[model samples]
Target: MWAMVTLDGLTVTYRDRPTLHGVSGSFAPGSLTAVVGPNGAGKSTLLKSILSLLPIAQGSLQVHTPRSRIAYLPQQSAIDRSFPITVHDCVLLGAWQAAGALGGLSNAVLDEADAALHTVGLCGFAQRPISALSAGQFQRVLFARLLLQDADLILLDEPFNAIDSKTTAELLALVADWHARQRTVIAVLHDHSQVHQHFPQTLLLARGVVAWGDTAEVLTPQHLGQARLLGESWDDHLHAA
Candidate 1:
């Protein structure tokens, strides 16, 4: 598989405090990679750095996608539910950025947005207001937006944080389909069990790279312990079992 996004010796800081330090990794096409760590582990920061949402203090980061080649699905908490927007409108917003000045949305863009909603099993609620959606349903709307982006790389931050089992399963299946279609997925996940169950590759971060390898191997007790106590004792578990 081709490398879609590559980061070498990447570093990021907030308020002069380093959040990501000397992180390096590569994401390939048709791959599902998970970023796992405890709170304040720089999981979200890493994704932001990749999306260029945050500036990199050092190191090199390369993205192979075109304008819409990479899409983002922010965490539910990041979304403002009070916004008076319909599900259809929200989904259509994905294409608005790419829309031409021909007035209304193009047929192709509308079709794609409809398909995205359908893919997430929210076709029936397309006209419903986003504020009326449940936590899981709201997430599906975001996923639909991701689908509408038609990007080869999708970045999701804690996508499964507060959803029910059924919705989580549905979202995972959608991600699997994208993977099958040769799209690359990078998600920040807190649930270790979900990482073990769904993602094959894992990037464990702790203001730095704790481990970056196969999910089963890197997410061991030592790494967990080190991640749990990142600022104080990452070296202790740097090479520990």
Candidate 2:
């Protein structure tokens, strides 16, 4: 398998305190990886570091995407809630990387955005103001934007938290389609059962990598116990093995 993202001895800090410690992993293309860990385990930190959104405190991380290779759905909390951008404009921004700094979007880019909105079942809301969207709808808009980006590696933070069941299903289906097309997916998931059901690979973390491999291997009872000990327990039985 082709490694789309690799982390070696990755460490991060916030306010002088370490968040991630000596983490190492290689994310392969055409595979879905669920990043599961207790709160404060640095799942979001890891993703941000890989995207270069946050400064790396130590270690090394690399994302290998061919030109237009990476797309990201940041934590909902990070989004500007009061921003006045419309859904269509938000999705259109996905093509900005391809458009470069000086170029305007082409008709093809708009078409791609439309297709992405349709895929996320949000086509009709294209003209709606972003602030008018519910949390779930907002996430859908981000997904639409990701589709427009046509990236090889996709990273999502807490994707199914507030979405309706239908939207959740659609997102999973879309992710599966991306995997089928040889893209890599890394999602920070809260639901252990859902992680096991939907993602073949799992990364169990607690300030560092507790274990990473097949879901069955990483989500074992021993690791769950450790995670729970760290007060990160949420449905420990769901991932017990």
Candidate 3:
């Protein structure tokens, strides 16, 4: 079978400078992979490229799943929590495409939204406005929405950034569940230890692929140091120019 997502010399530029340079890799079907690197290592950029949110300056990205079967949870910082929407409403939006096309949500879909909320440990939060939620609670809400999406290919950016240990463990369990069901899940994460414990496959990057393979092999001290040095080199080169 073909890979679920493939990148052949994928490159992305920002303000005429390449942020990601000739990055190439493929995510196998049902693979759970973590994208890791320094702050500006183009980790987030890769996720955006896969989602087609940003223009690719060169090469190609092929996501085998259909648009509707792909779900994305961007950084919590990017969401406008001030929007006047209830938690239930936010979760319900996960099924909006299908519900809209089908005229309305079926009762079963509505129940699924509630179940998603409950699964994420937000059982009584359905009627609360999202603006009132704490950062951890809000992240749970996002996970609940992802669950409702029931997507085949899920891309998560910084999924556990501000989450507490309990919340992080709960969310990670959900991620594990997704893997068990043969869904393709990719997340850009910062915590190497967390990635080591949870993700079996890793793509360590520094404006390009430093290492791509088993997490145990990719997150090595030497590889990590090299990634950091590459990031610093980019900074130094830009300062000189």
> Would you list the C-alpha lDDT of every candidate in the order shown?
0.86, 0.86, 0.94
Tens digits of per-residue lDDT for model 1, 44-122: 9977877888998999889888756778888888879899999998998788658755558888888888888888998
lDDT of 1 at 189: 89
lDDT tens digits by residue: candidate 2, 14-34: 987778889998998787999
Lowest lDDT block of 10, candidate 3: 96-105
Indicate which candidate wins on TM-score. Answer: 3
Instruction: Write one digit per residue (lDDT tens) for candidate 3, span 1-241.
Output: 7899999999999999888999998999999999999978998899888888899999999999898999999999899999999999999989986877567888999999999999999998999999999999999999999998899999999999987999999999999999999999999999989998999999999999999999999999999999999988988998999
Q: Model 3 clash pairs?
A: none
- What TM-score does each of the candidates earn? 0.91, 0.91, 0.97
Superposed model 1: Cα runs more than 4 Å off: 101-103, 231-241
Error of 3 at 33 (Å): 0.3
